[model samples]
Target chain A: METLKINYKNLYFPPGGILMWIIIFLELITFGMALVVFAMYGSEEPEIFHQSRLQLNSTFGAINTVFLLTSGFFMANAVVEFKAKNVKKSSFYFKLTMLGGLLFLILKSVEYYHKIDSGITLETNTFFAFYWLLTGFHLIHVIMGLVILIWTNNGMMKKNSDTEVVDVEACAAFWHMCDLIWLLLFPVLYLIF
Target chain B: MKKTLLFNYGLLILLTISTAVISNFVAIKSLAIGLIMGLSALKFMLVSFEFMELKKANLFWKVSLIFVLFLIVLSVVFISN
Candidate 1:
């Protein structure tokens, strides 16, 4: 009997079924709870809460949104480059995507500085608490995406170039998911109740 | 491939801009939110199918992603309602 070994490049399709759904469902659940808590037990002072929301630099949120979208665009381009077998080009896009992530982090840090200087912390009120919690979760995902990009780019530059493409795509998939989640967060946290 | 790719990306940008604009300008915030969420869902599906190459993927993988997304979105709707 002859055993045919599939190429390492095609080893694992992204995971499916219970585990995958469970992870996404978990995120949805957390977001739902955030919404419900925000509605029911959120700050008693609607005026203050709304004012706090207005105080939020929508400009910064909008800027971060653009950065994440640009990063997602580059990641999508990297997938194209990977499929074209242009490893160098793929790495270039990955680096650009990571740079976008870094820029978003820096802008967020600056926003945090202004927020803290204005005497608003997570402990200030429910509005601030939710703001920090939701944005902080997003920041963590950006950081995770950055780490994935670095690892995948390093592998692409080394001996395991071909095998790295799938993981790279997976990282892009996750980053897109992060961006999608922030799409909802932006309106809910910034514009709506 | 290039045509569909451009179409999807173009639609994605349009949807993003529309979501922001509608949510910001409309007085009916909840309805605006629903629209934004809908548009974002559409954008997510396009990205997953077109950009991620899931259209040519195996059935199990495709269905799993679709199912997962549906469930997640359903949960959000259910909880929000």
Candidate 2:
């Protein structure tokens, strides 16, 4: 009888793991449903949607987009370094990624402040309501991603720790999903009507 | 790999800039919408395939992610129209 061999390395599941991917799918669907509802409401009140979009500071949205993308880039590099077993470099890159997240939070808070000062609250209108709900939910994800990245970085910095490669990859995957959600949100809320 | 990451970063920035310019300068509403959404999709793909390492993922994951994006974009475009 011939013995059968399984090639574990050739398994084609997503980075992180199957559980992470399942969570990612669910998150994406939730955001997608929110956005579809947003679009439907916009269609119902075209003029209001258009006017509300104009009130948004696209410049801020554009800056936040750059920050998130850059952070994502750093996170990607961190993962690559981790795969290469370069712990110090990976940790450094993860810190940079966290820096980007911090900047995004600061800028987003400023934008929110300006909106609130201008008397734009969630109850202001349907557009403002969606804006607050969608972006607020995403902000919570960013906070979670930052925390995960910090934990992963700490693990990487420790010598001979049991922090598996999958854990680091899972952190990166979650952070990238945050970026993905923002990419969709930016266009729908800031650019298009 | 470093070079690929750098290239992806540059491409993402370029796409971001182009989308902003198109949406701001283009007079035709449909044209602006089409260009902006198209660029957004392109950016989304770059991030997914590169930063998210979707390229190394299984067929099921890749298809699911892309399908979700397609549905969202289609829904937005349809309802807006």
Candidate 3:
């Protein structure tokens, strides 16, 4: 019998799984660098950072948490429905998840408006610096997730055969990752003070 | 399936309340943070395993993904201290 040959492309990197792992690893590196910066500056001027952390509105963080978690849940449901081939329900939850992301951005905007109006600029101190850096980074991920959701929704609307289960899974994972990062960040920033 | 779904949502609501309560009680500081984060981790696991159906995923993907996640969290805790 002829020796079996493995196709490199088919061997691994099943599109969705590979993409998910890549994103997770990237986030890990980002968080690592952030921690290193925190360690260095945190050693030099602990109080300033600690004090700035106190300025974070736990209420806003909590609301965003609820929205993102809800979004993640809906996205996961959409994935399940997609697997079951229940197109209508999948579309419904996809839209719901997008709505959740939209609400999160709006709440964030309102929170930012209040902060800027109150003149709590990043120049306030080291704490504000980290506060802006960390939350701002997380906000970027939130926006990215929203864009993915929109694209997925558009694909579904257009009746594309690209199989959106991967999109649903990736978006849900990203949203969940965002929430997980904040789970640590909130307590570190708000509750710690 | 419906029951599991209901239970999942209920647990989520309970976890939410626990997190909120823990946040407000800052006197405990580290303890409160640990407790809330701990609960959130539990919530995330539930969503991943139950809601996302990772339980049915292939062994390699399931174990490796979880391992990576644990490693990430462990690194964070270590670096943080």
Per-prediction backbone clash count:
0, 0, 0
Query: Which pairs, if any, clash in model 2?
Result: none
Give lDDT tens digits, candidate 3, residues A95-188. Answer: 8888988998899888878878888877877767777788788889878877877877677656445645556566666666676566556545
DockQ of each: 0.31, 0.70, 0.29
Native contacts present in candidate 2, fraction: 0.80
lDDT of the candidates, in the order given: 0.69, 0.89, 0.66
Candidate 1 contains a number of clashing pairs equal to 0
Residue B1 error for model 3, in Å? Answer: 8.3
**Each candidate's iRMS in angstroms?**
4.8, 2.0, 4.9
Q: Which residues of candidate 2, in runs, are more than 4 Å off?
A: A1-12
The digit string of per-residue lDDT tens for model 1 on B35-62 reads 7657766766776677656666567666
TM-score winner, 1 or 3? 3
Candidate 1 CAPRI classification by DockQ: acceptable
What is the per-residue lDDT of model 1 for residues A72-173, given as tens digits with 9 covering 90 to 100?
Answer: 777888877776778888889888888888999999999999999989899987888989998998789779878878887887788744544456666677
